[model samples]
Target: MSGTSEGPTPATDLSRPSVTQSDTTMCPSTEPAATAVARQAVAAAPPAPPRSGPGGPLPAAALTPMAQSAPTPVGFTGLAQRPPAAVPEPPLPEPPFRSAFSAAPLAMAVVDRDGLVVSANDTFGTLFGGGPEEFAGQPAADLVDLTSDARTRHAYHEVLRGGRARLRCARRLKHPDGHGLWVQITVAPLAPESPDVLLSVADISARRELQSRLRHLRNHDPVTRLPNRTLFFERLSAALEAESYERGGSGRIGLCYLDLDGFKAVNDTLGHRTGDRLLAAVAERLTRCADEAGHGRTSAPLVARLGGDEFALLVEDSTGTEQLAELAESVLTALQAPFEISGRRLSVSASIGVVERHAAGTSATALMQAADTTLYWAKADGKARWTLFDPERNARRMTRQALVSSLRAAVERGEFALEYQPLVGMDDGRLRGVEALVRWRHPQFGTLTPNRFIALAEEDGSIVPLGRWILATACRQARRWQLDHPDEPPIFVSVNVAVRQVWDSDLVADVAEVLAETGLAPHLLQLELTESAVMGSAGRPLQALRALSDMGVHIAIDDFGTGYSNLAYLSRLPVSALKLDGSFVRGFQHEERGGTAGRPSPADEVIVEAMVQLAHRLGLTVTAECVETCDQASRLRRIGCDTGQGWLYSRPVSPDRISELLGDRC
Candidate 1:
């Protein structure tokens, strides 16, 4: 082996010891060798035959034959002897460090200052292409394929130049026999300030394989075995980043976010295991759809299970909205078929939101949000279909979101107002009552009517507080009207109530409190609900209505004949009036109708007359809505409708206008 010293040569094996006439320094010192030789010389000299002269015993070989066989009575030297002395052998010099380096458990090699392999051990050569000598003069960096990338190449050069303390990196290497392995390469200075470094290679194939398996498990869904939400988000971010950096790319991306309709009922009725199988089946179908969608594209789409029954397909470099729509339509068609789970066939449908756009300024979060919103629109438009993202629709949804977030606050800020429409007696033309309607005086969009925001309120449960506010404000106005018109019959105030108000809030308590607070008689305060909200209402809602009725408040079914009329239900309730739906009135006036220019059809008249006669038999008054002309009012009067409402009487007006109308009626 070569040797290094403080002299001329800069390279040598740091394991072997050597000596020369001019240079005595070596990797291992010579003291142990000299000591070993001295110990050997001392052990080689024979001990003098155990003291045969004087009082010491004679040698066994010199003893007479008779003396050896018989015991000597005085000396007792007849074979009475101690065991032989153990030889004091010299300690073995340590097997050479060169031997240890050559037989190292791990593959090892030494590199010269030029970054070329000075020598490689047997293990190192075995890991490389050939024997130890074959690796001589070869570049260490190329041996491990470290030059494949510029970053790692630069780092290796830094280690060779002794500028870096150490270089530890992992590499994937393929052997000459066609097998592959993952190896960790460690390079560091052989000694302090030594340019020549030792390179150690450790095979870590098993560890790398284990890590890869664990990563796959962590990133995939257990139920469907599809990439999970974490992987989806990662891919989405990566796609966006890649698009941002590449100029030749498609520059557009799209996604289909879908949710299986009525999946909860399946999960609730069937077991989660069955639901899991269904999800897996759905994932398989979605993957096939993605593959089909990407037939002509450079890369296929990614299908991932977001959670539960929701899944997403990501398309990088998408062409446009049309392509995304086609993909969504295909997915809808695919999922429409029955999914057989646990030997029972289950039919399911999916609502998908399709969104596609240029990727230049879009972020993963923004894209996903757009997809989610579009999916909701798909469900809202109708389930079992797909809806492409429309900017106008998105803006409307954003407006709705803003309203929802601010709804409760708006009530506190007093952003709502009430208007009253008078209900007049059809026969006498006297004011019977006023129906209170709500309007939102928005700061950005002025004066939004109930048609715009009532449903939104009902959905988010903000209607509870808002409804309470309407009841209190309307009752106060009616009480003021009574105070102003004491000489005349006190007209009741009718307030429209949402069914949610009955379920979510204490309706009986709210109405009773308002009536007591405003000093209004319960009979003079009327609470109106849609026929749909009134019919089949039991449990809490029914109890609330009955309690309110027992408090002497009138309970009128609004928009009568629009829903399940359930005439049988009316006879059992404390209902006071039925306001015919405006649709029935519109039937008499529409230009496309079969009726004469401005006359009600006999069938329409008969429907109205029968409804009025039935209500009269049930001891309930009837109010006809949407009476825009005197002829409609006269016709309703002939039908025996007790009260009339709509444009003919008055459009819903301010409290002052209603007061003036009441004064006029008096």
Candidate 2:
């Protein structure tokens, strides 16, 4: 049913071909005209447009080869042969190597093992005012300024030898401009595969400026621009340690700690700003001392501000005490000059304490403490001076300090007791009165005399309480004695009063209260005062003395001639008796023998006679102290002295002993 209509036949029914089963061994029949037409179409077409522009185009002969290559299949006689398998193309090789040197932020360059510049980055070329072409294959060191130190070259070599992977060096680099630029160069090994070294340079001018500022702050005082305490101590410790190791421990370190005596006044009068300027001037003078002391020596003692008006100096390896003394003297001389501050010239002096100690056992704290203590001593001994450390004085000071600490509780603990020494009638050999003396029966120190602790008591202001206790105790004892010995003439009990007791307390009220409480008549309770102590009385002291005297309390001047002998004023005073100084009476035995074994000298007799005459004329009785011998006593009696007190009568005795003496007299 392959009929074709006139209009191109019915398309679906144009051709129908079938093959019977069991035809697997046979080829399918194909139209020979269709296969010939396809071959002719391919072979007859002009060759495809040329792939690339050429001088000539493909010929018709080339098309004949393409037609012969097509195989004719037996079954269809039109199938084309499949092409052979295509081969894979090899991967393209990596691009040629380029240096990373040109991309580094820092000026970078690659140097060969021999320190030759194999390549350089843009930064490096720009730094040296040359392009990479000019620097490549050139010696890297050639661009470095010749005046650059050898240390930089050595560091570079160290990095190149692989001794260090990276090195930092400061070097001067030549620039196109006249001046060279300071740079810090860092060199590092580039890669394991190459012997090239990578160098990185950065201009460090700003960093160097910051470093200089830091160094200045470290070594100088912020207030005065002088060396500070830290630097001074550092230098001192080093010097001392050096000397100790060098001399095998013979050398000494001397230090002087000085404080301006009246600097606080200056600061208060002027402003602190002016004080600061004055301090600067003082520092200059002190530094000059250090310089002069060092002379040509490389190392010198450091003078430093320890803060405020205080300063310190470290003297190393002093020759001896003489050298230290000289240094102290120099300091005094230096500080004597006036300082001009804020247009005013102010005069100031210094009190310096010097301590010299060997480095063997001396520590910084110990040395500083010694100097501080000595400085206080100088201030106390009177300002504008210097004092040297003395171990003996320090020992005594410690003892006094211990005593002071124990004194306030002494009276309350019943550690204090009173002893009495009788003042005898020189002519009658009769008891006239007794002087009350305070003693301390310390549990640890045994018995302490008045001389030992009285000064300490006065210094610490404890004497007022202690003195009150003495007055009360003495008055009570005197009343008791009067009660027991009614047959004997009534004897007065005289208690010594300290200046502090008079000044710091109402001594008159204390004495009146004691007399009233004990029922001891005022006439029997006499108060003894040193002449200087009485003279030192102010308004209250004079009032206290007058009130006591008005109460019938006999006031006697003790140690009369040794102090200010204002007898004219004494007459106006309420004092009833003048006790001649012990020193004058002890010489009495020398008078008759023209210098007997223990006799008063003729001059002593004259003085004693004159004192008695004067006292008599003033309606005052005279008592000679320290009448130790019968001859001395006899001489005093002959001189018209009314009373005598000494070992001749009896040494100061305890209450029990006094009871026994009074009992015997009765």
Candidate 3:
């Protein structure tokens, strides 16, 4: 009530908005008859009772505390504070979920908040037997045997109390029927006022069995029925890891990696089926050998087949190198016995590489690498034997490998230089031409002769670039020599060429480029090759030599008579000269009368004479190599040899020395 005088009712007061009987009676004459009826009904009905909390009924004063304690204030009008809004009713549970769950096809159970089973479905009861009611009061984790592990049991309990939203795990269990079963269990929290969990179980036995079979097939070799490379590496890695974290053990590992020698020939001759049978037999023998080696040890060595014609026996916690050596010897002896395959008797031999060392610092990769290197050593040493690893020998091989890796770089960096050996006229004892010999000036090993790295270069195709460099460098030097001694005959320079250079690169193009660049005549350059390199080769080498000879480049057969001296083919080739091998000249160095040097045996003289006569008849000059004395030169002169190259003139010398020789002869 407002503090107005005498409390007269105000018709425009907004504080009292309800329609009274007087106001309704004085309503406009045009008002609708329905509105009048609603007003009368509202005025007739009483107001709603005050809302209350769950504990008890609440009064109007209790809802607005200021209204309960304060006196009325004039012109200060407002609504009292409102009570809080009522909470909404929860959604209705869909359908008859219990009936559907009870008869559901899936095996399921309900777990209470305490982790005990509240109920189970018909399918679950049938799966593990003993009806649905019997599952009650049992721990839910016990249904899938999760209680065996405390961690999983604790996680299950956490899921039941709603701490975790869901959980899934699998286990292998023995059923009441005495059969093993793999079960996948899933726990999901249910939505209810009283919190609970829904547990599901699935039989995964078939899937588990399939996975096991797949693992077996993947880890074993089909041909030999032994562990394959993948499994071997796996086991080796595990062993290394275990040894790295050793606990009072030997911390040692050993391996015997073997390869069947000439196994490819067997496969080619008898067919792969026979090869497979032979391999299987060999695996059995190796297994037996490994078992024998394992006597009085913790376990037998693991026998595995890595790939084609390769097998390994891995020993963990090896006693010493003697154990690995014994195992290798046993393998060699076992594989010696002949095997009958495809109605053919096959005798095979294995080369075994034995390596034993402390495993604490080694890895699978390093061990396998060492074993592979040692296996190569065994094969190179000779088949049908086992060789233990030696660090010094390995270091030498490692050095060779380093040299191979650095060869191309060395060539590019100009680490090679040429030395010229004078080839003299045998009759007049004058310099005819100089042979260009190449040497490697290694930074580490000082100067190295061609014999050290030439073969390696040839094997890896590095010889092509090296040969190109040699040709260019020698042609340039020869041109310079001609410039230095304008009065001399402009002596020719002979350079040795490896056979691989012809096929592996554009030799004719390289030589033409070099001659064009250096402004040197093609006739001033001679290319020498071993007899084996030129005698029997036809295709590319033939074409290259013919093309070069047509270009005025001389092709001489070097180290003659040491190889297939098919003298008949000599006339067909583009050869210009033949250099007799040093072996023949060394015969002249042999003593006869104990005190005085004598002529070579008649056999040597006749061979030289015959070779010289044949060459002269074929229109090719003959050069005698390794002549150290005037008697040898006179003998070669009598044999009709056109030129002689040996220490008699001088050892291989620098370009300056060649210039000095040319200066004197001029």
| lDDT of candidates 1 onward, in order | 0.77, 0.71, 0.77
* Candidate 2 weakest lDDT stretch, 10 residues: 1-10
Give the per-residue lDDT digits (tens) of candidate 3, residues 1-666: 111221322222212221111111122232223222222221121222343333344332221222223322211122122233355233222223334565666677767677776566677888787777677767877677767666767677767666665555666666778877776666654432225566777676677677767878999999888999999999999888864437666889999999999999999988898889999999999989988887887789999999999999999888899989888888888988889888888999999999999988888998988999999988998878888988899888887998899999999999999999999887776677899888999998789888899999999999999999888889999999899888878889999999999888888999999999999999999999999999987888899999999999999999998999999889899999999998888786666544465545667778888999999999999999998888888888888999988887899999888887874431
lDDT of 3 at 542: 92
TM-score of each: 0.74, 0.65, 0.69
Instruction: Return the TM-score for candidate 2, rounded to 2 decimals.
Output: 0.65
Give lDDT tens digits, candidate 2, residues 1-666: 011221111111112211111111112122123222323222222223222112233232222223223222222233333233255233222111222234444576657778876555577778888775567656776665311445556656766786654454455444687665566554555533335566556776566556667866886798778777777777766765655548544477888899998899888989888888888898888888888877876456668888888898877776566767787788899988888888898888999998887766777777888899999999999989999999999988887788899999997888999999988787777777889999999987789999999999999998988999999999999998888888877789999998778778988778878888999999998888899988666677788889999999988899988888877777678788899999887655554654455444688778889989999998899999998878777777888999989897899988667766763431
Cα lDDT of candidate 2 equals 0.71
lDDT of 3: 0.77
Cα-based lDDT at residue 320, candidate 1: 84
Candidate 2 lDDT for residue 648: 78
Error of 3 at 69 (Å): 40
lDDT of 1 at 88: 36
